[model samples]
Each structure stands twice: as structure tokens, then as C-alpha cells.
Target: MLIFLQERRLPLSLCGWQMRNRLIYLPISSITEWFAIPMVNLRVISLAAPFVLCTSLFALSLVQAQSLPTKKKSDISAPAPQAKTVSLSNIPHAVATAFCETYPNAALVSATWVERNAETCIKLHTSEGTKTRDLLYRLSGELIEMAETISPIALPEAVKETIHEEFSRAEILSAKRLVSAAPTLYEVTLSFGAEKETLIYDAKGVLVRKVEHLPRAVQKAFEAQYPRAEILAFSKQDEDGFVRWVIESREGQSHREIVYAETGEVVAISERLFPIDLPEAIKETLAESFSGSTLITAKRLTQVQYHISVSDSSGNTMLALDATGKLLDMDAQSEHVLLSLATSPAPSQDLKAEEDAIAPIPVALPDPEVDLAVALKPIKVEEPLAAIAAEKKERPVIIVRRYYAPSLGWIPPIMRLWRPSWWW
Candidate 1:
């Protein structure tokens, strides 16, 4: 730097320099100040200035680099923060006009401000009837994700195809939507176009299952064993946190219900069909996986997972740890869990595959506009919508009660006087 500076000027009178750290500012226009200080040799000044100039240039460049956007998950890794949220009230009429025009058929039931932004998260109930085509829209007057209403019977074929295509023969025993303003993925039924099929999606939008349908390849293997068997529409339930599809297969009119764990591949196809006498391979596998877990209870699936309960030495139940002792239950248990936990021992109560896929399976979500800067802010609350078709699920009777006396079943004639005719 000194050599360069000297070249730029010339072999002139030596002007001494004073530096604050590495600053090379020369005190000029003051002979007294200059003469008072000994001249720093041009050679030394050159060596020192180079380091100062380089460091200063680099520091300046770093400050500028900070202004550029850092890597966003949306761009590389997982989905980053949403775009800026715009309030519905604040959206221009043109945008509102576009929404109204776009989703004219969709019934707008409720709207809430998501991310405290411009777009409104709208809920729409598209039910053909009490039992047919019930859907929950996550539409914020825009095309986003959608979820199926719980116990939505007579599901539309279009929505059903979306599920089949997505989960594609995957047994979607259950699904749910994690809390999100505009979730990229859903935990509940997968949808394409207007149709929906019961399917659970990971937070990353990976498809896990469809109701009663295991992955196609796995189903084919199961089918090979039961050649003439046809599936009698089955009901799915969570047996120890796994989505177990209790399939009723009929061959030549002989029908029997068989439970199969839902999974993409045959991770652990059961060896025995009869009431499972704990297999040594399975028991040791669970013990080794849940190293410190205390085996609590064990239930058997015909061909898949052994639902067992084991808790840590500390007494906290080990709910969904894998065969390797890894606590893998981060999200709500879907029927898809049957596969992931196949080899692991259930060390607690048989967890049900989550029926309510999520708090609310959002359908038709808003175009995400979450500003990365403001993602940490609390999400605003919306008024709860009336549950139109929330089917009541009856808990299975674990213990049967025997009636001791006939009079206990109903009040005797003497107590009938208190019971009004209307009550009867």
C-alpha cells in the first residue's frame, strides 16, 4: 500500500502517519503536527498499508454481503417462512375479484387472518349431503391445500383418485394436518383437484398411506396369498398407535377379517396368524431397541407389529420409540405408524392411530405469505366453525360388564312414576 501510495504521489517530502489500529490517514496541511512525528519510511508504510487496505476492503465487503439474502429453506432445504401475509380487508378489490371469480362454486364458510397478513384463511364446508362428499377447504380465496372432514362417507371419486395417486394403494388408515397458516404438506387426506382420499402426509409432504390400502407392491404380495379373495370394505383403527387396516377378505363367499399393518414395504410381515405367542426375535428386538424400557403390555397383530408397552427406567412410558430405541414419534401417529413401529415394542397403552389427523385438516390454504422475519410471531386465532359432520367414535369396550339383576337394567314399576312419558 505504501509503495502504491508513493507511486501515486511521487518521491515527495516524507509525511509521517498516525494510525488508529490500521488506519492509514495522513495528517496533512499541518507542518507542526507532521514535523513533531518521525517520518514512517515509505517501505514500512507500504508493508503496513497493504494489510490495512486489504482488511478494510474485506470488512467493507462483508458488511455489504450481509445485506444479501441468506439461504432460505424455501430455496434449498425445507419450506422457508411464508411470503408476506396480506389482510383480506387490505387486499385490493382486484385481488378479491379474482378470488370470487376463481372459486365461485366453493362455499365460503369462515375467514381468518393468517400470519396477520393480507390474505384471509377461508374455511369452506363442501358437503353433498350428510354422508356424501364432506370436505374442509383451506382456501383463503386462493388455491392451497385441502383436508377431508372426519368420517366423511361417500367420498368423491376425484378426491379419492388424488389420494390413491398420492398414496397409491397405500393404506391410509389416518391422517392429520399439523398447525400451519398455509402448510405445504398435510397430515390428513391427500387431494388433487376437487377430489380427496384419506391419506396422511408428513410435514415434508411425503405420502404415507390411504385408508385400508397398503402400498401397491405390498398389497400385491398379500394378494398373491389370497388369490380368490376380494376386499370387503374395511374399517381402520389405531391399535397401539399403528394404523391397522382390519381387512375383511372373502373367497367364494367365505369371509374373514384380517388385520394388516399399513406400510409402503413389507417391513415385518408376521410369521404366525394364530394368537401370537411372543416371538423371540421380536421380543429381543424390542428389548434391545428400548434398552431401559420396561415392557408394560403386548398386543399382537396377525402379520405385522406387536403392540407392546414399554417405559423408560424413569417410568415415563416409551410411547413410539423404534426398534433402535430412537424416540421417533415426533408427529401425530397415523395409521402409517404401523410400519415404522413394526419391529419396535409398544411399551405403553396401544395408541390409536390419530383419528383427528390434526387440529383441523386445512383444505384450500392461502398462498403462503409468511415473512421469514415474522415467522416467530404467534398465529392469530379464528372463531371456531360449527362441526357439521363430526362422527362420534365409540371407544371399544375393554371390559365387559355382567348384569346382576333384571331390575338393574331398567327401573322397576315403582320407579316408573318418576319417569315422565316423554322420557320414556
Candidate 2:
């Protein structure tokens, strides 16, 4: 069969398979057969054919070389990466609070986004509070432009474009340096373990705050970190020059207060609650749970109202107390939860756009005691300090506690603890 196929012009079908796979094969032994046809008159034909064949082969070689491996490019010269862009710039409520508290100058006084025929003017705060300005700019990558009083710097576009093209840098490292030197108004936010720290800046390129977010997850995880310490309240202190935070903790037989500087690091001292006079069992529990604190406050948390406050280097914890001395819940976090719980009866399904539209403009937020010293004035004390000191000395040294469980947001304490009363 092989001899028959080879001898009688039999088709071996080599070209058929070769065409399917697009592979070409050259036979070295066959070259001489074509030359044999040429000897008859073929000086010109022979010379031209050899040159043409060689040129075709050279062309094939070029194509094959192009099909193989490629060269490496230096990523070092590439542009910095950008964040996943978002349209709505929702400044966190906490960040808003912190901004207003720390640098009242940079606060957003009012925001008006024209909706329909009427301009919807949302006043950030009323009653001569913080001064604020909001601005818009065209931003690309790390380069920001179109600056108003509140906008970032305005440089020539060519300079900026040249910088972008020629300047290769680790944007992350650059950001770290910038953040270390000053706070950034991030295009987005970040969540750390149980807490969410959202960073924001003012027009002056100053970090306004690492605004803390307390989610349910954070509150629940709080116990795991400090098993003995209970967070009586999370405070947002609006100092004249800086923002501060304090965590009120209770330990066995004593209470401790830990204050954090603006950077969220403890800048001050940890005070111990002193001269414990609570029931022995309560004292023992406190001793087991907390170190005593110098600062203390009486809090009166009734179903209606409560004021949970923690003091400072003043060496006093002055909280208002009712007959049964249960600590009050007057901090922003508590008030937020209460207000939410109170209005939650009407579900989202019941809410309509028309109803929201018809709703009256929201009342301005009362200033946070937060900066209570600035926002509220201390009542005039006519009594002499000696007498006041005597009264405080005679009063029982007790740190009152109030437990808040979201499950029981609607329930009030059935009974209260009793303590010695003072003659106001």
C-alpha cells in the first residue's frame, strides 16, 4: 500500500493536514530537483528563484520571532493607583460632630442642594455654633484642583500633569507621611477591629478628627477586651483647642477613668475611684473588676431622662442621682440609641417620600456637653468650699452604675439603689 501510494500520483494528503494545522515543512533533498529543471535555460531564473526563496524564508523567520517571548516593562515608572470612586460624599455624623467640636471654624454652616423647584437648605447648626465651609474640586488620582477658600491648592495643569507623568512614587507611603504629619479627608473610610475610625481634614490641611464609630459589634466586643471594665459612656469632648475622649470603667470595689488624647492615645493619667463606701458585695465586685478612680459622677438614668457624666483631673465624679442612685445615660451614644428606639415603631415600609418631604425642618442639634464647660455654664454655688467639702466628705463614696442592654431599650429599671442624700 505504501508503494502504491508513493508511485502512481497517489495523494498522501500531506498538504491537507498541513493546511489544517497551518504548519509548513521544507524538504532539503527536494531543493536539487527544482535546480535540475533550471539548467536548460535558467541562469536568470535560477538566480531570481534562489533569491526570492531566501527572502520568503527570511520573512517567515521574522514572523516566528515576533510570535515568541516579549520584553519586561518597569512598573516603577507607572502612575499611582486610584481609589474605587464613589459619587455621594457622605461625611459621617460623628466626623461632623468632631469637626464642629474641635475647630468650630471649619464646620459646614449650611448645605443647600437644589432639589426640584425649591432649594433644600439644610442648616448644619444654628444658635451661633461652629463656622463651616464646604467646597468642590475636580480631582484625578492624587492631584486635586479647582480650589475655593475650602478647596485644595491650585497649581498649573501642565505642572500637575508633568508631575503625574514624571513623578513615580509609592502613593501609599506618601499618604502615610501626609497622615502622620496631618489628618486626611479620605475619599473613603476604614474599619479597625471593632471600631471604625474615619479621618477628615479641614481646608487648612489639618486633620480634624479620627472620628470614632460605635457599632453594635463594637459595643459587644468591648467586654472581650476589658472583661471587668464597663463603658459607662463614650464621650466626645469638644475642648477649645483639641478633641478628646474618655472611657469610664468600673473595677471591683473601685472605679477608674481612662482619658485619651486627640490621637486616641492615653495622654493623661488613669485615676482610681476612692474611699469606697458601697455595700461590701458591690465593693468586692468593683475591686474584682476595676481599679479605684479619683474622678466620679452620679448619673440618674430614668425611663424619661438621664445624665451619665465622667469628670477629669478635678478629682470629682459629679453625676445627678435620684432616690435610688443608678447612674444616668446622658451621653450622645445613649441619647442616639434612645431616640432610635423611640421612633422605630414606624417601619421603613410605612415611610414615604412625600411624608419625608412634608416633615418639618429638623431642629438644630444642641451643643454637646461634649464641651460642657463651653456649651453650659456651671451654676453659681453660694455655699462656701469648706462646707461643700464637709458635705462631700460626709456623703458616701460610691460609683453608681447603670446597665444598658439594647434588648431592653424599652424597659426601665424596676428598682433603684439607695444612697445618702445631700442638702442642696
Candidate 3:
């Protein structure tokens, strides 16, 4: 056995396995050579070899498992919470009771359930009088926040006094109140003549901050386009989740309103135009198409379209035209006004001129003395009475013309004496 062990190069110091610092290379032939020893020794080596091999494999697997990468607790993410729309009836009793107690006059517009952190919350949209409100509350009846729209008149007396004292000439446009803040907060939008701004205030009506101003980008863009324009009004509006800025301004005598995106991009423009400001083509079209009509209002929309309102003997008309003076549409308040004037009854002739041209000639009154002399001397008859009568019957009689003159009032009829042919 010792010779075989020596040939196989097996270390005789197996009892010092724990103290061995270097790796030991065990070949398959070394184990096979164990069978060459006595049968009793072979059995003992076989059993021990299998056990040691299994133990080594198990230890290798454990080391590999420990060396593998593991994710930190912070790196793991929880699923996002979702909000669900629900009816007022479906809301928790506690939440509803809390909302009613807080906003007794508010009418529910909508209610929704949302999961936040691990707790369930309720959101409500409500309206009170002319004001609209949004509220959030936890399931346990704890109020989270409340935002409400309010009019200028609804501002607290302290806030109103502050604004009046600070900005005496400013007109309040809108007011909003946030109840979530520790001291509560008020946001007030005001206009000082043409300029507008938003201001924030605390519950005590102390001015906190100014929240709005003409953005630098917008100011640069506007100045580049209208260098000499005076800003009339500046306001911000939100439409469909997009923010827009509106600027009303005037350059010389021209008034214009421009809409701009948040990025200072011009979206649209509206310009107020006087009749004299219109293009030559437009003026000519208006003169030819709507003769004798009064131009009420004219506006240029986006430099492309023109809107004009005109009034005439027939009725009022609204005209939509393009920049080239081409009429796109025309709407008349009265349908008869739309008809061509040529189809109407012909205008009456001037009767006053005709009457002046053929005015009745005034007959000269004979002298009273000459009439007396004629009456005294006319006794001679040219023929028998029957001949004179027959001659008078053959003569034509003259008829007098009469007319009414409003300016001259009524005129008396003119009388004339008839001279017989026999007397002549």
C-alpha cells in the first residue's frame, strides 16, 4: 500500500488538510489507484471519496451564489397609484360628510377616488354660486387642500383694502384662493390700465410675491415686430392644456391684437381698421358694391381676412372678405336688401322741375276804367244775337292749371273775364 501511494504521489499528511495553504490537485487516477490497495482499504476510500466530492460541489455552488449581483431595496419600485372616477354616492360617508361640513353651500360637480401612498383619497369638484372649487380629502375625513375660483368682490376685506391702498388705479380681473397653505393664500390678477400682472397674498392680506410678467422671449419677439407699438393690454390664457399670451397694442393710429404661444410664436393677429386704413382694392369694392352705405366697423383678422359691417337704406350687412377685396361671404339682416337695386321699382321723375318749366302764366288784370269805358261804348252788334251766340259756341275755352307748393302754402284761384267775339 505504501509503494502504491508513493507511485500515485498521494500526500501522507492528509491529517494536515486544514493547515494546507496551497491548492491540492487530486487526479482521477489517484482515486482509481486506491482500488489497487487491500479490499478493506478500498471500501473505506470509496465511501469517503464520494462524500468529499459531494461536499466540494456544494461549497462551490454556495460561493457562486454569494458572488452574484443583487438589487438594493431602494432600486426596487412600487406600482404607480391610479385615480378612478366615481359617483357622489360611491364616495365614503366620512369624506362626504367632511366635504359638506367644510363647504356647506357647494354643489358637487364630480367626485373621484385616488390611491396615494397606501391611503385612499377623494377628490371633488364643486360649484358655489358663481364660484367653482376643487377639493381633496383623505378617507379618514382629513382635508388635504381646497382651491376655489372667486370674483374680485369676494376677496377678503383685508385683501381688498391692501390692493386699493397699493394699486389704487388697478382693476381686478380674477381672484383665486388656495386653502391648503398654512396661512392660506390668495392669487389676484389685476390690470393697471393696459398692463396686467398677477399677485399673491397671504391670509393677512400681506403681499407675498408678483407671479406674472411679460416673458423676455415674448417681449423680444413683440419689440422686434412692433418697435413703436404701445402695449394696450397683456394677458395669459390656457386653452386645451396649452398656454397662450394675448397682447393688445397700438402703433401710431393702428390698433392690433396678437396671440402668441409660450415659445413666443405668433399664432394669430386681429387688427382694428378704419375705413381709411383699408387697402385701395377693399375701399373700391365697398364703394362699388355697397354704394351710399355707411361703414360701421371694419376689422382685419390675421392679416388674411377682413370683417366689415355696413348699414344702408335696406338694412345692415356683414361682409367677410379676403385681403384682395374678394368677398367670401355677405350676410344681410334683411333678405330684401340682398336683391339687386336694378330689380326694384324705377325712381320717380322730378315733378318739381317739370312744374317750374310749365308754370301757369298770370293773366294781366284790365284797368277798371277801361272796363267801364268798354261797357259804356259797346252797344253795337255785328249781327243778330243768334249769329253771335253761334260764333261764341264754336270758340274753345281755356282751362286753369293748379298745383300745391308746400313751401308757399295755399294760393287763391286766379279769376279772368271772358271777352266775346262779337265785342271784338
Candidate 4:
């Protein structure tokens, strides 16, 4: 047991009970005599004692180890790297040189060191005129990626041509360029009437992505409502968490804009109108209340109301009227105007046409048969009445016939009933 204990290098406390009883070092004969046990049983107990003590010690140690606190794998892991701001002068020579060479006109705003794809990189913010640019570069002075805000006029000819070809009437709102991209790219925002769209294109002017489309429900509703309307542009918008679709269309010379809800219900509509297109009631109302007022602009909303801007001697004023030509909201002045309009009778169509008609001018007919001698001949009162009557009957009477002109209604003919001695 002792030899086994020494080889195992177990502590003496493992067999403390045996030591307290003074049985650990006792001989087998003494053990048997003291306990009055048989020699064979004593030998067996002595050999098994160390084994049992060692087993108990191992079990106790394992239980104690399990009860203690230990660190978790996540707690010992390394932290992630974060970006750190740095000054331009602190940047490496290669990085600074490359940036200056690439953007000589750019003014630096900020610089930072960031980890990208497990490699250190430098990020730069720069400005040129009103535009701003962001660039990412490697420590080896190689450009990784760059994005720059630009004006619409700075776009390449190819890109401009592509946009014009696709949307001839579209107005560009903003433009952005991305350098060092896989194929380079440009992002453009355009406005068509009240609608807006964003289009992405490659450097070669090829369209890469377009994200403007109406919902199926909205498309169906608009098509059903305005089957003959030529759609110029359409866009989707989210207002205060509510989604809507806006469309601009044209029907002949008139333009219209419409808004629709996600469920395909119309929210609002505005249609542009010419002065000549105003309703008869509206024209009469304007003539009576705002005479001599030149119309600046006119629009009808949902066919329920008319909003018109007019300019007169007093300056411009906007008026809102209903379909029946009644003011929507009337003040004291407006009430007076309305009362005057109500009291006065509108001119009839025929009267207005006659007042606008142009006056006719009569022209004289030429006579080619009368000779100079006959024209110069004088009438003699002493000559016989029958001879004078015969001479007058032989002469050609100047009868001017007037005809109706398409533009002018009719012209009266002039009759030459009397002639001077020199005019035959």
C-alpha cells in the first residue's frame, strides 16, 4: 500500500482515517492479532485500503473542481477592430500622394483608418464646389472604392443621351457617380411632372437597375380610369407610413396628375385647363366679376372645383370656384361682386358674335368700255329728250356686285347713280 501510495504521489490526508487508527504502518501479523482476524482477511484489507482511499480522493477532487467558477469562451475572445480618425499629415506618403494626384482639385474634409476585409484601409471625405465625395484606399495607395455627389450637367454625354432617349421629358433632379466599382456606376434622380424616379446606370451608359413601378392594383385602377390618357411618368411614395402612387398623364393638349392609395382608390386629381376650355358658366362669371382680368393659369380639381390665377390692374389674385361658378368662400368684397354678377344679365351668343364680327368695306367696280372721248363728252339740255335717252340707253351702266367672303360675312356694293361730265 505504501509503495502504491508513493508511486501515485497521493497526499497523506487521503488515508487520514487509517493513520488516526494507527493501521496504515502496522504489520499484517500485528493487524491480525489486534483485530483478532484471520491472516488471509488481514492481508486482503491491507492491499485494498490504498485503492479505496485513492478512489474517494479522486471523486472528491472532481466534485470540488465542478463547483468552482470558470471563464466562458466568448468572454476570452478578442474585440473587433474599430475605425480611428487620423490627420492628413499622419497618413502614409503613398496614400497621400495617390489621393492628391487623383483629386488635385478636391479639398479634404476628414480621414479615417478602417478595417475592410481584414485589411487596413484609409477613408477620405472631400469636396469640390457644392459637391461632396467619399473615397476608400488601401495602404498600398490602391483605390478600393469611391462615391461622389455631382451635378446633372457633369454627367457623361452617353449617360445624358441614354436618359434623354428613355425619358425625353424628364428633368434631372440629382446625380451621383461611383468610381472603382466593378464596372463603375452612376445614380440619377429625375422628375416628370409630379412624379419622381431613380435610375442606376453603368459607366458605359447601360441601365443597370431601375426601381420605379406602380403596384398591380394601382396600375389596373389608373388604366381603367384613364384608358385614353398617355402616361408620361409614374412613381410610388410613402407619406407618414401610408403608401400612395402618383401618375402624370396627358390627354391631347391637356395635362393631368392623379394620386392613388395602395388599394387602388383615387386620393386626388388635378387637371390643367386653358382659358378657352373654361365652362360657359365660369366664363360668364369671370366676365361679370373680373372683367379685363387676364388668366395666368387655371386648373380643375377632381372636376369639382376650379382654381384659377388671374392678373388685373390690381395685380394677381387666385380664385376658387365650384362647378356652378360660385365662389367657394366669399368675403364681403366677394359677396358684393357676386351680387353684381347675379343682378346683371349675361350677353347672348348671337350678340357676342355680332360684337366680335368685323365691318365690311365696299370696293368700286372698274369699267373698261368707256373711251376718253365719250367720258369727256358733256350732256346738253337743249338736245331732244328722245336723243339723250337713246344715248343714255346705249351707254353701259356701272353695277358693282358684292359677294360674301368666308372670313367676312357680307360686303355691300356701291352704286354709281350719277356721273360727272368727265365720267361716263
lDDT of 1 by residue, 1-424 (tens): 1311232333333444422323233444353364564344533455566579889999999999999989976467433333333343533344355555754544332222121133333322232222111122233334444444333233334445665664564554334333334543444544545554655454443555545445554376568777787653445556455555445454542334454545432322212122145788887897789879855324343333224456566764535543223344535555567687887876543344454343545689679777876888888765455232232234344788887643534666444544557663
What lDDT tens digits, residue by residue, belong to model 4 across residues 126-155? 776567787888988998998888879889
Candidate models: Cα lDDT each: 0.46, 0.41, 0.71, 0.73
- Per-residue lDDT of 198 in model 4: 86
Pitting candidate 1 against candidate 2, the one with the higher lDDT is 1
Where's the lowest-lDDT run of ten residues in candidate 3?
A: 408-417
Q: How many residue pairs collide in each prediction?
A: 49, 28, 0, 0
Task: Point to the candidate with the largest TM-score.
Answer: 3
Candidate 3 TM-score versus the reference: 0.27
241-324 in candidate 3: lDDT tens per residue?
Answer: 667677877665466778776677776687767678799999999989999997744678763446788879998788875433
**Candidates ranked by lDDT, best first?**
4, 3, 1, 2
TM-score of each: 0.18, 0.17, 0.27, 0.27
Best-to-worst order by TM-score is 3, 4, 1, 2
Alpha carbon lDDT of residue 84, candidate 4? 39
Task: Quote the positional error of residue 370 for candidate 4 in Å.
Answer: 99
| Candidate 4 regions with alpha-carbon error over 4 angstroms | 1-86, 90-93, 112-118, 192-196, 210-424
lDDT tens digits, residue span 1-424, model 2: 0111232343345434323323344453443464455333544564467569889999999999999977656455444433232112333344344444644544342221111123211112211221123331111112111112211124233423433453333121111112223333332133444533444444344445565654444345445646876554355555454555555555443344444444434433343323343457766666777756532322222232234556578864646432223343346445668866887766564476657678446789986557757668876666697889889889987799999654533443321111125411
Q: Which stretches in model 3 have alpha-carbon errors above 4 Å? A: 1-86, 90-93, 112-121, 149-158, 193-196, 212-424
